[model samples]
Target: MRFSVPLAALLGAGLSEAQYLISEMSFGYAGRISSADNPGVIPNFVVSGQPTKPEILSSKVILTPVAPGNARGAIWSEQPLKHPNFIVDVDFRASGPDRAGGNFNIWLANHGKDIGAKSVYSAGRFEGLVLVVDSHGGQGGMLRGFLNDGSVDYSQHHSVDQLAFGHCQYSYRNLGRPSQIKMRQTSTSFRVQIDGKTCFETDRVSLPTGYDVGVTASTPDNPDSFEIFKLVVMSDTSSHDASSNSGDNNNNNNNNNNNNNNNNGNSNNGNSNGGSNMLYKKQSSSGDESFVDLADEEADVFQTSKSQFQDLHNRLQGTNHQLSSVYRSVSRHHQMDEQRHNEIKDLLAALQSKVELLDEISSFRQRIVALENEVRNMNNELHKKLQDNERSVQGALRVHHNSLTQRVAESVPGHGKLIAVIIGTQVILVVGYVLYKRRRANSPKKYL
Candidate 1:
C-alpha cells in the first residue's frame, strides 16, 4: 500500500516546486490466481446479486506485484486529490473477458451522492479506457473513452463482430499494460498511454474537483469476466481533505445512531398506509430516471444553442475573410494603375524628344533650300551686273580714248592709258559686291 504512495514525503516537499497538492489514494483489482503454483495478491469484494441500493464493494489493495512476473492493477479515488494537479497510474492485467453488466472494466465518477433510490448529482459520469482484445479468435483490443452521461468526448472501440482470438495467434490485445493517467484540475484534459503508445486523450472533461471519486463494476446479463490488476490514486491532499478527518469515525457513528431512530419512526407509520406509501415511493423512485431524462433534454437545448452561436460566428469569419480579399485586390489594382501611368509618362517623354528632332531637321532642310535659291539669284545678278558694267566700261573707254586722241594730238598719247585703268577699277568693285552677297546667302541658318 505504501508503495502505491511512492515518494509521498518527497512529493509533499516538492509540491511547492511542482505547484500541486495530493490528497487520497486507492487501488482496485479482482482477487484471482492464474495458477496455484503462482500465488499472487488479488483483491475482491462481494456484491449482492441484484441492485438493491447500488452500493460499492471494494477490497484492500496491494501495491506490489505478487511474483517476479506478476502484473499490476488499476486504481482511482474521490476528490480532492492532494494537489490540484494529480497523476494516476494503472498497471493491470486483464484476461478471460466476458459480457456482464455492460462489460465496462474501469470507470470514474465525480460529484455524486446516493439518493434513497438512485445516485444523484449536479454532474457525474463514468469515464475510462476500453480494451479490445480477444484471445479465442484473432480479434484485437481497442481503447475507448466514454461518459456514462451519454456524452462522448473521446472513444476507442473495435467492431462488435470482430473475432476475439484464434489459434496460433498471440492474444491480439494490449494486456498486462502499464499506463500513467494524469488529470490536472486547472485543465480538463486527461491523457492515457500504454507502454509508449497513446491510448486515449481528451479535453472535454469538465467535472468539478473536491467531489466523491468512486469505481464500480457490474455483472451484466451478458456476464463478461475480467479483472482489474492494480490502481494508484494521487490527488491534492490540502484540498481533498479540506476538513480534518480526525473525528470522521465518531461522526459516522453518530449519524448511524440517528438513522436508526429515523427508521424506527418510519416503522411506526407502517400501518394501513404502508402499501399505498410503498407504491408512492416506487413511483417516486421511477422519477429518478426522469432526472436523467431532464438532464438529457437540457443538454440537448444547450447543444442546439451552441451550434447556432457557432454558425453565426463562422458566418462573421467568412465575411471578414471576404473583406480582406477585396482589400488586397484593390491594392493590386492601384499598383497596376501606377505602373501603367509611369509607362505612359515614359512614352510621352520619348515622343517629345522625337518631335524636337524633327523640327530641327525641317529647319535645316528649309535653310538648305533658301541657300541654294539665294546662290542662284546672286549668280544671275552678278552675271547681269557684269554685262552692264562691261558695257559702261566700254562706253567710257571709247569716250576717253576719243578725248585722249584729241589730247594726244594737242598734248600726249599716254593719256589714253589712264582712262583704261579707271574702267578696270569700276569692274573690280562690282564683282566684289556680288561675291559677298552670294557667300552671305549660302551660309548655314545656325550661324545666322
Candidate 2:
C-alpha cells in the first residue's frame, strides 16, 4: 500500500527534499462483510444508502446497489485528512451491465458520513471537492470535478447539475478493466490523473482542513456498481520550513559527533604536551627550553607529512595492481572474441558453399526438364509421320486390289466357264503330247 517516489525524479525536478511517505491504506485490513452483517455496524467506514451492507470481498471495498430499482451507496473514511498538501492514489474498478447508468465519486469533503443520498448522484449539503466518474448520457465515463460551497441544496435533488467546476472524459464503466486515479493536491493547485494521464489540473481551487476522504456510487435501475481495491494518501513532507529544520538537525548532530572526536584527540595530545612541558622545565634550568620546543614541533610536522606520503604511495601501488588485472581480463576476453569470430566466419563460408551447391543442382534439374520437353516434342512428330504413312499405304493397297478384281471380271465374262475351258485345253494338249511321244518311242527301237 505504500508508494515510493523515485529519487532521480525528485532530484531532476529540483525537489530532492520533497519526497516523504505519509499514509497508505490497502483496505485489506477491513474484515469481510457477509449477508448477515449490518452496514451501519462496520468499523472505520461509514456506509450510507441502500439496505444492505457494502461488502468487502477479496480485500476490495465493493459498493453494489440493491436490485429492483435505483439504488445508491457510499463508504466514508473515519480518519480525516491530516495534510493540506498530499497525493491520493486509488485503484478501483467501475463496471456493470453494458451501458448501465451510474457514476462513482471520490470525495474530499468537509462533511463526514452524510454528504448525500448516495443514489446515482450526490445528495445532502456539503463543502469541499468531489471527483465524479459520470458514466451516462452522451458523455459517458467523463471525469469531472465539483466543489460544493454549501450554497446549492443537494437534498432537494440528487443531480450534480451546476455544481461541476471542471470535467474530463474517461471510459471506466463496464470496461472490464481496472482503472487508476492519482490526485495531487497542494495549497494553491489541484490535479487529477486517470491511469497515469493528467485529466484535469487547475490553480484556482483551494480546500480547507478537517475534510474527510471517501468514495460513493449510485446505480439507476440497473446492476451498475464500482469497487475500490486500494487507496493511498501521502503527505508532502518537502515544505521549505520542514526541510530547513531537518537539515539543521542533521548538521547539529554531525557537529556534535565531530566535537566528541576532537575532544578525544585533544585529550591524547594533552598527554604529549604534558611530557613536552616536563622536558621544557628540565631544559629551562639549563637555559635550552625555547630551542628544544621549536625542534620538537618541527619533528612532529615532518612525521605527519611522511605518514600522508606513505599512504598515498600504498594506494597508488594497489591501483596499479588492479589496473594490471583488468588489462589481463580484457585481453583474454578479446582473444576469446577473436576465436568466436573466426568460427562464425568459417560457418558462414560453409553455408555459402551449401547455397552454391543448391543453386547448381536447381540449374541442372531445370536443364533436365527442358531436355525432356524437347524429346517429347520429337516423339510426337515421329508418331504423327508414321500414322500418315500407314494411312497412305492402306489406301494404295485397297486401290490395287480393286483394279485387279475388275480386270479379271472384264477379261473372263463367266469365271466358271473360263475355268472349265482352260482345264479341257490343258488335258487335250497333255494327251496329244503323250501319243506323239509313244509313236516316236516305237520308231526309235530300229535306230540306236
Candidate 3:
C-alpha cells in the first residue's frame, strides 16, 4: 500500500489528470492535423475529416464535397490515457448546412477497450466529451463517465445523469471564425472556453485520466468544412510556486492528501484491501500543469444553472397567478347572474299585483252601470202609471218610488258582494300564477 512509484510514471499519470487538451483547426502547423504527422489524414480516425484522396496546397487541407453533400471525419488517440481529470478543446470552421451527429463529433473516449463501429463501454470504463452545433446557436456540451457496475463485480451500476456542465455556441456560421476553444480539469472542477471567453464550467465532473482523445465531424444536408489552427497540451501546476523553496513541505502535504483520500474512498466500497490496486504516490511530486479558466469557470457554471432554475420557477409562478385570476373572474360573473335573477323575480311579482288591481277596477265599474240602469227603469214605470190614472197618482208614485229605492238598494249590495268575490278570485289566481312562474323559473328547467 505504501510502495513508491518512479517520478516519470507519476508525472505521466498526473499529466493525464491535469493537462488541458486544446485543438484550434485554423490550417496552422502546415495544415497538419493535431497529434498526426500526415497533412490531411487524421490518426485513429474512425471517420475522415478530409477526402481520402486529399488536395493539399501550401499545406492547406482542402476538402471537396462528395455527392449527397455531406462530409464526415473522426480522429482518436493511438494509446489510452488513465488520468482522473483533464480538459479538452476543439475549434472548427463550418459552412453550408451542419447537422449534429448521434454522438458528439468532439469527444473524449475513456477506458475504451476496442476501436470500431460496435464497441462495448464497460462500467467505469468510459467518459464522453460533446459539443453540439446547429443553425440556431451553440448547444450545451457534456462529459459522461460511469462509476460502478454489476457485471464486473459490483451489485449494480451507479448510473450518472447527463449533466450540462458547459455550453458554447457551435453554430455553422460561427465555426472557424477566429475562435479559441479549451477544456481544463482541476482537482475538483472542469472549465471550458471559446474564443478566450468562458462558456462551460462545472465542479461535478469526476472522470479518470488516460482517455483516448478524438474528433468526429458530420454535416447533414451540405458539405461542412473545418479549419484547425492549433492543438496544445499542458499540465496544471498552479498550486506550486517555483519562487518559494518550500518544495519539501508541499511534497509531503500532496502525498499525504492523495494517499489518505484514495484509501478512504476505496475502503468505503466494502473492499478491505485498500492499496492493492490503489494510486501510486511519489516524492518530489507536483500537480498537473494544464491551463484553463479556473476561477471564472467555477463561478460561471454556478451562475448559469442557478439562472436557468430561477427562470423555470418564475414561469410556473406566472401560470399559477393567471389561473387564479381566471377563477376569480368567473366567480364574480356567476354572482352577478344570481343577483340579476332575483331582481327579475321581484319585478314579476309587482306586475302580477298591478294586473289584479286592474281587474278589480273593471268589476266595480260594471256594477255601477247595472245600478244606474235599474234606477232609470223604475222611474219610467212610475211615470207611466201616473199618466194612466190621475186619481191616486201621487200615492202610486210614492209606492213606485219606494219600490225602486228598495230594489236599487238590494241590487247594489248583491252586486257589490259578487264583484268582491270575483275580484278576490281573480287576484288569487293572478298571484298564484305569478308565484308558480317564479318557482318554475328558479328551478332547473329549459327557459324556452
Candidate 4:
C-alpha cells in the first residue's frame, strides 16, 4: 500500500511546509527563519546613515536619537526578500513634545541608488511600497500608504499626500507602550494592520520577488523620538513557489512591465476593502504534484520538535529582555513620581508657613486696633473730666464776680478791679492745662 499522508496533516503534525524563516534563508533570501532573537548575534539589518552600526540587543535597534532639527532615521535589511508572499511585524514607538511633527516609515522596494539627494532611506529611482505612520502634531498617528516606481524625485515632491491610496488615523504616539505595524504581501494583493486590527488592504497592489525592507523616521524642529523594538519578517512561500514554477518567463516580463509603471498610478480606489480585514485569496493546489513536493520535503518529527523548542527558547529570551526594559521604564516613572510627590510636599509645607505668617500679621493688626480704641477711650474720659472742671470753674467765677460786683456796689470800686485780675489768672491756668492734655493725646505713642 502506498503511504498517503495529506500535507495538511503534516503541517498539523508540526512540520511546517514551504514557509521559511528569516535566519534560515539570509543568503539569497533562502533563510527559513523561525525567530528574530539571537542571544549574541547582531540582526541582519544594516542601519542607514550612521557609519557605526549599533549592537542589536534583544532585537531592539535605535534608528535615531530624539533631538531637534530634521534628522533622518533609517535602517535597511541586509538581504533582499525573495518571497513574494510574506508577513512583516514591526513594533515601534514615537514620542516627543505634543506639537512635535514626528513620523516614521516602513518601505519595501528593490535596491536603490545610494545618494543623499534621495531620502537616505530610499533610492532616486526606487520602486516599491511605503507605509507612513505620521503623528499629526501628536494628535494621533496618521497611517498612510504610498507606492512608488522611482520616476519622480521624492526629495522635491511637494504633494505626496495626494499620492496616498489608502489611509487611516489612530492615536499611536506617546502611548507609553509600543504599537505594532503588521504588513502582509501576497501575489494578488497587499494588506496592513495596526495592533492586530486590519486598517486597509488593496488588491491592485502587486510586489515581485527580490524586494528589500527598510524603515526611516523624520521630525520637525521640535524633535520626536522614533524607536523600534523589533522587526520580524516571515513568509508563506508555498503559493509563491507554485506561481514562480508555473511560468518563469511570464513573471520576468510582468516584473519589467510593472517596474516601468508610474508610482502615482498605484491607486487603491476600489481595490481595497477598507476596515474589512478580509484575508487575501490563496492559490489552489495544482493536483498530485503538490503532494509529491510535500512528500519529498518530509522530515523527522523529533528534529522538528527540537527546532521548535529552540525557537521557543529564543522567543522566551527575547521576551525576558523586553520585560527587563519595561521594568526599567516602570522603575524610572516611579522615581519621577516620587520626586514630584516630594516637591509637592515641600510646596505644601511652604504654603502652611505662609498661612501662619499671615495669621500672625492679622493678630498684630487686631492688637494695634485694640490699643487705638483704648487710647481713644482714655482721651474721651479726659475730655469729660476737663469739661466738668471747666464747668465748675465757670460757676465759681460767676459767683465770685457777682459777689465782687455786690461788694463794689456796697463798698468801693477799687475792690472790683482786684476781683477781675484774679478771675483772668484762673482762666489762663485752665486754658494752659487743656492745651497740654490735647498735645499729649495727639502725639504718637510706642507701646512696646
Candidate 5:
C-alpha cells in the first residue's frame, strides 16, 4: 500500500496540476509476476481462493486453469479506493475451445472481503457493486452489472438473472488477443468501454468511496483459461487521503463483524428498500421505458424526483464540458494571434527600409533642380553684360569719326568727299555687326 501511494505521488509530481481533482486515489496498481511457479508479490494487491492459489505468471494471472471444476480464485486490491474520479483498464483473455462453464468478475465492495468464485464469479451478495463477464451459458459471453446493500443472495435463490440491471453480449472466448475493458468514472458519470468501444454508461449511478476493487474467476464444471493480463488504475489528482474515511471505516467494520450475514436473507424479499441500492434499466414493457435511472427504490413516488434531479445534474455537467472546450479553443487562437503579430512586425521593418531608400532618391532630385536654376541665372547675366559692351564700343567709334572729319575739313579742300566715304564704311560695319548679333541670339544657348 505504501508503494502504491508513492507511485501516485510520482505521477502527480511529474505532471502538471489537474483542473478537477486535487488529491489522488491511493488504490492504483500494475500487475506483475516473476515466473510461473513462483507467485510474485505485487504491491497493493492480495490473492485468495478456495482451492489452490491462482498461478501468477510473468505476463498474466491465471484465475482458473483448464480442466478444473469447482475451482475459484480472486485477486483484489489491498486498500480501499477513496478517489472518486478514476479509470480502470483490465486486459484479459478467455481461452476455451467450446462452451466451458466459467465466469469472470470485477468488484467494488467492502474492504478486506475475501472474494472467491461465488455469485457471478464474485460474491452473490456484496455491500457495493459487481460487474460480471458470464461465459457459463454456452453462448457468447455476457457482461452484466449488479448492486446490493448487504442483502439478497442470488447464489442461494438463483435469481441473478431477474436482478441484473443491464447487460450486453460480447464474444470474449477464444480471442487470440487480450480483450480490453476500460471503466472510466468521473464525478458525474460512469462509463464502460469494451474493446475500445463504449458498451454502456450511466450518469445517475454514484459509487461510494472507500471500497476495494477486485477480479475473480470461477469454474462450476468443465475447464477454461480465464487469465488476467493486466490491471491498471489511474486518477487525475494528487495523492491524498480521503477526509470522511471514518464513516467508511465504520461501515466496513460493521460488514466485517457480520461476516455470517446470510446472503440468502429474505428480509426485503429479494430486494433492499433501505440500504441496498440496485439499478434497473427501463424496459420496453414499461411505458416509462425512458426511465432507465437506477436507485434501490422500485418504481414509486420517491424515485421520480430523484430521477429528475439526476437528469438536471447531467445537463449541468454537459454545459460545463462545453465551456471547457470553448476555453481550449480560445487559448489556441490566442497563441496563433501572437505568432501572426510577430510576422507582421518583421514585414513592417522591411517596408520601412524601402521607404527610407525612396526618400534618399527624392533628396537627390531636389539638388539637381537647384543646380539647373543656378545655370539659367548665370546665362542671363552673361547675355546682359555682352549687350552693354557692344553699345559702348559703338559710341566710341562714332565720336572718333566725328573728330577726324572736323580736322580734315580744316586742313584740306576735299573734306566733303572724305566725309561721305567714311559715312558709307560706318553704315556697312553697323549692318554686319547687327546681322552677327541676330544670328547668335537665334542659336540655342548651352547651359554651363
Candidate 6:
C-alpha cells in the first residue's frame, strides 16, 4: 500500500517546537527589576509594610528588615505569567548572625495586583499556590506547599493543618553556601526541587490563570537575611514529536519502495514525469526491476534544512533583542552620568563665586580695621593738645596774680600811721593843684 503525506502537515509539525524563554532577571545589571519601566523588562516591585525595599547590592537583590522590630515585607512581580506550563528557577542565599530562624515564602498568586501586608503570611483569603521555606518556631528547614481554592478564608494564624497541602523538610538555612530552587508546573502536576533534590511533588495540581510570582520574608528576633542572585521564568511550548513521527513515516515509505523494487521483474522505461513521480519498469526475461524515488529524499533534506535555518534565525533574533535592551540601559546610564557631571560643575561654580565673595569681605574687614586704628590715634593726639592748653592758661593766671600781690606789698612797705597821713596830704595837695590847673585850662579853652 502507498501512503501520501501532505507537505503542509509536515511544515506545521516543524513549526510547533517546544521550550521558549519568557523572562530572565539577573540583578548584576545596573537597572533594578523593581524599578524597570520597559514592558519587555521586569517591572518595579511594590512593597508593603515596613520591610526593606528590594535593593540591588553587590549584583544581587538584597531583602532585609527595614527596622529592628517585627519587620515583615513582601515584594511581588508586577507582570503576570504568560503560560500555564512554566518553570521558575531562582538562585538565593540565606544567612543570619545567630541561629537561622525565619520564614521565606514564594507565592504564585492570582491576587498579585492586590498583594498587600497580609499576602506573605497567608492572612486573608487568597487564590493560588504558596511554596514556603520556613525555619521558625523550632520548625527548622521546613519546605511546604499550600493551595488556596478561594472558597475558604485563611485564618489569622497559618497553622500547618489549615494551610499546607503537602510538606517536606530540608536543611536550607545556615548552609554557608548558595542554593538553587526550581519549580515546574503543568496542567496535571507540580514539582519543587531544592539544590537538585526533589522536595515535593503532587499529581493533583491546579493553578489559576493570570498568576503573578513573588517572595516575602520575615524574622521575629533573629537577624535573618535573604539575597536573590538570579531569577528566571520560562514557558514550555507544545509537543514537537509530530516532526519526528513524520520523519519516521517517510523512512517507512522509502523502505516499502525498495522492497517492491526488489520483488519486481527487470524493467527499462526512460519516461520521466518530473522528479516527484516514482517510476517502475520491467524487462522481458532479465528478472530485474528499476525504481527511482528522488523527490522524497530531496524533500526530506530540504525540509530539515529549512527547519534548521528557522531555528537559527530565531536564536539570533533573541540574542539581538537582548543586546538591544542592554545597549539602551547602558546609554541611559551614560546620559545620567553626564547630567550628574553637569550638576557638579554648576555646584563648583557656585562655590567658587562664594569663595570670591568671602575674599572680598575679608579685604573690606581689613580696611575697616585700619580706619579704626587711625581714628583711635587722632583721638589720643587731640586729648594731649587739650591738656597742654589747659596747663598754659593756668600758668598765665598764676603769674598775673603774683605780680599784683607784689606791687601792693611794695607800696605799703615803709610806714604805718605817719606814712599813711603824709601820703594822704601829698595826695590832697596834688589833687588841689590838678583841680586848679584843670579849672584854668577849662576857662581858657572856653574864652578861646
lDDT (CA) per prediction: 0.40, 0.63, 0.46, 0.61, 0.64, 0.60
Candidate 5 global Cα RMSD? 30.9
Write model 5 residue lDDT over 9-119, tens digit each, in one string. 644443342322221221223234443354464456787766777877766778888856778878877777766787777888888757576778888778536554454
| lDDT, candidate 4, at 282 | 24
When 2 and 6 are scored with lDDT, the better candidate is: 2
Clashes by residue pair, model 6 = 34-44, 265-288, 266-282, 266-283, 266-288, 267-281, 267-282, 267-283
Q: What residue pairs are clashing in model 4?
A: 20-32, 21-32, 21-33, 22-33, 24-31, 24-32, 25-30, 25-31, 25-32
Winner on TM-score (4 vs 5) = 5
lDDT of 1 at 371: 100
For 1-448, candidate 4 gives per-residue lDDT tens digits of 1222542354344332234346522311223222344442434655554332323344355554566456666677767776768887788887777777656888787773242213423344567878888854344668988778778666567766677788888798688988989888777788999998889999998888777777777666786777777676777643333344455335334533552341123233222211111111122343111101111112343254444453344345335544654564465556545654664565556555666777788899999999999999999999999999999999999999999999888885577788989999999999999999999999999898
- lDDT tens digits by residue: candidate 1, 376-414: 999999999999999999999999999998987887457
Query: Candidate 4 versus the native: TM-score?
Result: 0.45
lDDT of 5 at 308: 47
**Candidate numbers sorted by lDDT from highest down:** 5, 2, 4, 6, 3, 1
TM-score, ranked from best to worst = 5, 2, 4, 6, 3, 1
Candidate 3 structure quality by residue, lDDT tens digits, 1-448: 1222453355345434432222221223335552345544444433334334333333333332333345444445555443445445555454434343222234455533232221112123334544443332235333322233223321133422332334445433434364456777778787777666676677876556556655444444555454443444444322122212254456446655765765565456442322222333333343222111112122343345444454344344335544543454465446545644554455445555665776777789899899889999999999888776776787799999999999998877457889999999999999999999999889986686
TM-score of each: 0.29, 0.47, 0.36, 0.45, 0.47, 0.44
Candidate 3 lDDT at 147 equals 30
Model 6, total clashes: 8
Off by over 4 Å in 4: 1-19, 24-41, 50-56, 112-124, 136-139, 238-448
Better of 3 and 5 by lDDT: 5
Which scores greater on lDDT, model 5 or model 6? 5
lDDT tens per residue, model 2, 359-408 = 78889999999999999999999999999999999999999999999999
| Model 5 TM-score on a 0 to 1 scale | 0.47
